[model samples]
Target: MDIKLDDLTGSKIAGLINEHLQGMALNSPQESIHALNLEQLRKPEITFWSAWEGNDLLGCGALKELDPYHGEIKSMRTAKEHLRKGVAKKLLQHIVEEAKKRGYQRLSLETGSMDAFEPARKLYASFGFEYCKPFSDYKEDPNSVFMTKELFKK
Candidate 1:
């Protein structure tokens, strides 16, 4: 699969992001939802990417720069037909590699704490992410699970 930097203008990417938002809403309470919308994901601090095979989109993910040394993962979603095919894993690996190349010392993410999110939590843990307190603008929320991995320790 080819993973490329996305500008959030394509219809495929937009639809995938909308689906992600809908999934978040369905699984988490309104007050605990932190998933960003298309416009929000387009912000200058965030770098978005989409994975594709030929013309079909497989999945997408984003990395938001919190500071020179830290970054956050966001909007990780594998297309319905592509679930369990390692699409999320490839997208996640791509994001982590990009963070390392950018000189980030830490990578973090927030996902739901519900059972629906178990696979995601397991995926992150497999990549060395450990449960942590909220980071950036996030506050403690029972509905949210935060994980972080140190890429380069000082």
Candidate 2:
């Protein structure tokens, strides 16, 4: 699979992001949905990536620079047909490595708290991300689950 920085203008990425938003809507209330839209993902602080296998788009993920030493994971989604094929895993690994390369000391993310999000929570846990309080501009919401991993030991 080839994973690289995406400009988010392609139809495949746009469709995938729309699917992601739709999935979030299905699983969570509108107010509880924190997933960024394409315009929001294009902000200067965010770096988006897409995974591809030849002509097929496998998955995508993004990293947002919250600060010089901290980053936030965003928009992690594996294409419906590509589920369970390690697409999300590979994208996540790439994001983490990129965060480390940027000299980030911490990497954090927020995901849904519903049963629909169990797999994502487990994936983050497997990466050594521990449950944490709301960081950055996020607030305490029962529908949200916040997690963080320390990239470098102090």
List residue ranges in candidate 1 displaced over 4 A: none
Report how far residue 54 has shifted in candidate 1, in Å: 1.0
TM-score of every candidate: 0.99, 0.99
lDDT of 2 by residue, 1-154 (tens): 9998999999999999999999999999999999999999999999999999998999999999999999999999999999999998899999999999999999999999999999999999999999999999999999999999999875
CA lDDT of each prediction against the hidden true structure:
0.96, 0.97
- In candidate 2, which residue pairs get closer than 3 Å at backbone N, Cα or C atoms, i.e. clash? none
Q: Write the per-residue lDDT of candidate 1 for residues 1-154, one digit (tens) a residue.
A: 9999999999999999999999999999999999999999999999999999999999999999999999999999999989999999999999999999999999999999999999999999999999999999999999999999999987
Cα RMSD for candidates in order: 0.5, 0.6
* Best of the candidates, lDDT: 2
Q: How far does residue 54 in candidate 2 sit from its true spot (Å)?
A: 0.5
Error of 1 at 96 (Å): 0.7
